[model samples]
Target: MRRSRLSTRGLTEGAIQAALVAVLALLTRYVPLAVLATTFLMPLPLMVLTIRHGVRPAVLAAVVSGVVAGMLSGDLLTGVGILVAVAPFGIMVGWGTRRGWSGPAIVGMAVLVSGASLVVNGLLLLAFLGINPVQQYGEMVLTMRQQMDTAASLYGRLGLGQEAAESYRRTMLAVLDLMPRLVLFGFVATAVTTGWLNYEIARPILRRVGHPLPALPPASTWRVPGFALWLLPLAWLISALGWQPVTTLSDRLRSSLPPAPLPVPSDLGLNLLALLSVALLVQGVIVGWVFLGRYRLHRALRVLLLLWLTFNPIFSNLLLIVGLVDSIFPLRERLGRRAAPAEVKP
Candidate 1:
């Protein structure tokens, strides 16, 4: 039985990996529009692949993403550069797993991956685009300002405070300080999602192939609100502990902000209300977790997560419809049995 299960698990993973690669390859045909409109989507699949299989597999997948992207866009160097940049996420995951690191450690690794990708991409762009390094860096600053402005505008509309708006803006740029690690975090998160999805999709197929399913980790009670709440304190704790250095860096960036008119509001009440609303929302999330046991909540959350990911860049409106259908139908749950509990070998 064990041997059969092992064989099945291998086949399932292999099949899923192949499917992902093939889909990504096909999607490459749309890279031109996708890249100019939204660069975020380009590296995402490669990042997901890296998270699941570690560096080697991620690199292999990236190679494929690169090839397809190159052919479709006629930008082989850029495609290959993106692949090279993203592949390290797999390495970070592999290194972390091998070391048996904690959640924060994994997060740190992700930060490294993001930073490296950003740096490598930036350098590559500068070298090939016939742009001076200083000019390129200045463009990055402008780009960041635009993103900050967008974030601030949204927050302001929501009645968020100047301090909070500023804080958030600072955080956005501050993330660049640990770009590689942040990217890695994104990759790792995506990886975990992929693993869960794989297990779900693979289990039934393996069983049909005369193999037992790979064991799955016990489900977490997934309350979206609750999960968000739990994450708040952890985020706060990290921020508080890391504030000094962050502030020092922020001061430098603030000095660099163009001496142009600020669009951010100065309303204290709006800001206060915004912050309070955010807090209450977080509190509600935590309370929901307590009220709802983890497992059922987790199931709903997982479905939502998968839907969002599959439709990422969110242009594939069909994926959203599919998500709604899956949420209503839940074929995965109804069809697949719970994986056998892993045995403790100690």
Candidate 2:
């Protein structure tokens, strides 16, 4: 009799959570806060359900949410979008937390889910909806070019010489041209960032709800594995060696100094370079945090330092380099050891 009552209560709770998830999913389709809700808030209800009720209940809630969203939006595509864009992320994060995974490991899982969802959704759209994302991206680039051309006078009014303005336009166009080719990498990066942000937001809420949550290591103590540094050199070598023949051909064609052929780095090389840079940047930020705590830096100084590193490309690169060297050398560990006796002495 007691077991039956417990089972009944569990089902009731799951239904309530499912309804909440459905409501939030429906809200994501409306105006005003649509983009913000879809991007950041839509996953929270599912995440809350998963944390409170376990995987089975959470999965059921997600399916219910999708169906309700589809019915409300008057299209099955809404359900498909929820399944593709939101369900996997919430499920993975919740499962990872329940399984006691570290913050980085959970984040890695989220990235994989996000990237796979992007590919799957793209294929679905092309196969069923007759929409080619690549063609749409190309159209977007053309539109941007047209807008930039119309704004040439504004550039001139900003004191840019014709040559400088033209160079700026060319640079912007080049980035747009590259966007379609780098879509996969961009998706993965976005997923990784979003996963981290969501995890940070969810951690405190989960704790408050009586879920077992692991504490992340302090930023000063954080250390990425050292082998990531090897990718930097490998990426540079591949970039230099992969396109020699193309470079030679382009040089021959450009004897009259017309626009040179744009050199395209191998996708693998670009991915490796980008991933390594991000890892090192994270390590650098942790090292900075350690310094601030060890030396008791003022709050305002710390904020100013962060803003400077964020806005200044040169300083950012320097931080990345510092992070790379620290990965191999364990600079923070050494410094902490040296400071220990002084700290202990009164």
Candidate 3:
């Protein structure tokens, strides 16, 4: 009787969560304004189901939600899309939460699962729908290029100066050149962002339900692993040696022939630099936050100041330098509130 009761309760909860997911999916389909918020929140119900009832019921809930969503929308793929987008991410996060994983570890696992779902399911979805990703991407690039050219011309007419307009065109072209190479990284970044957002949204709700999620460690204590110090040099070596995994894979994927391989771009190094620069910029913000703490500024003020520094082109470069220096030396241990340097003789 006890086992039967537990099973019944689990099925009841799973059904309720599946209904919620279908409702959210319908809202996304019918309501335009709610998409930005609702799109991310769609995973929450199923996530809670996983946490409360476990994976088996969560899987059932996901299947029911997908079918209900498809049937309601009159297109089966829409249901598949909903499942592909939200299920893996939500389930992984719930699993991690149940296992008492740290915030970072949870997000890390969730991102990988989310990214894999996007790529693998995306391919199958496109195959099912007879859509060509390469052709779609090409059309997107063409439209963007045209818009950029128009903008550059408008800038020239607006007296932003010919030099400024030309520079802008060059910059935009560089970005366009990089887009294909960075698709994998873009997907990974999207996964990371979504995982973090889900974790944030679920934290308070979980606490309210008597299950508290782990919080992130303070920014000051956050350290890039020592091995990461070698990434910058690796980036340089990739540039020097022309080992273009990103570019080569990108080329092969877009190619019609299985054996076709494209020559490595001269600026394959730029791809590595672009990824590393973004990472270092994050580290730099952490370093800057630590330094700001020394002056005892309010937390809000420090965050605002960091934002300003990051957005300012000049200061942002300086921030990257600070991050690199901090990574190499124990800047936090040395500059923290306690522990003056031995030579300083405090």
Best TM-score among the predictions, by candidate number: 3
Per-candidate total of colliding backbone pairs = 22, 0, 0
Clashing pairs in 2: none
Per-model TM against the reference: 0.34, 0.78, 0.84
lDDT of 2 by residue, 1-346 (tens): 9977766665677677667666766776676567674556666666766665567777777788789888988978778888787888887887887677887788778778877887888888998799987788778877887888757758988888888888877877776766655655676687777767766766786777776456666667777787767778888666554533234456557565543233555665666677777778878877776666677788788878877895576888978887888999977766554243544555
Off by over 4 Å in 2: 1-3, 145-155, 159-181, 243-265, 292-295, 333-346
Candidate 3, superposed: residue stretches over 4 Å from native: 157-159, 243-270, 298-301, 336-346
Which digits, one per residue and each the tens of the lDDT, describe model 1 over residues 171-213? 7776544443233344434444443343344335435644333
Q: How far is candidate 2 from the true structure (C-alpha RMSD, Å)?
A: 5.5
Candidate 3 per-residue lDDT over residues 1-346, each given as its tens digit: 9989988999999999999988898888889999887788788887788888788898899999999999999988768877788888888888888788898898788778877776877697578977766567767887898899899999999999999999989988887876866665566677778777777887887788777778877667776666776777766665666634343456557464433133454245555676678777888888878777787889999989999999887999998887777777887656656545679556
Which run of 10 residues does model 3 get worst, by summed lDDT? 257-266
Q: Write down the lDDT that model 2 would get.
A: 0.72
Question: How much does candidate 2 score in TM-score?
Answer: 0.78
The positional error of residue 219 in candidate 1, measured at the CA in angstroms, is 20
Which 10 consecutive residues of model 1 have the lowest summed lDDT? Answer: 260-269
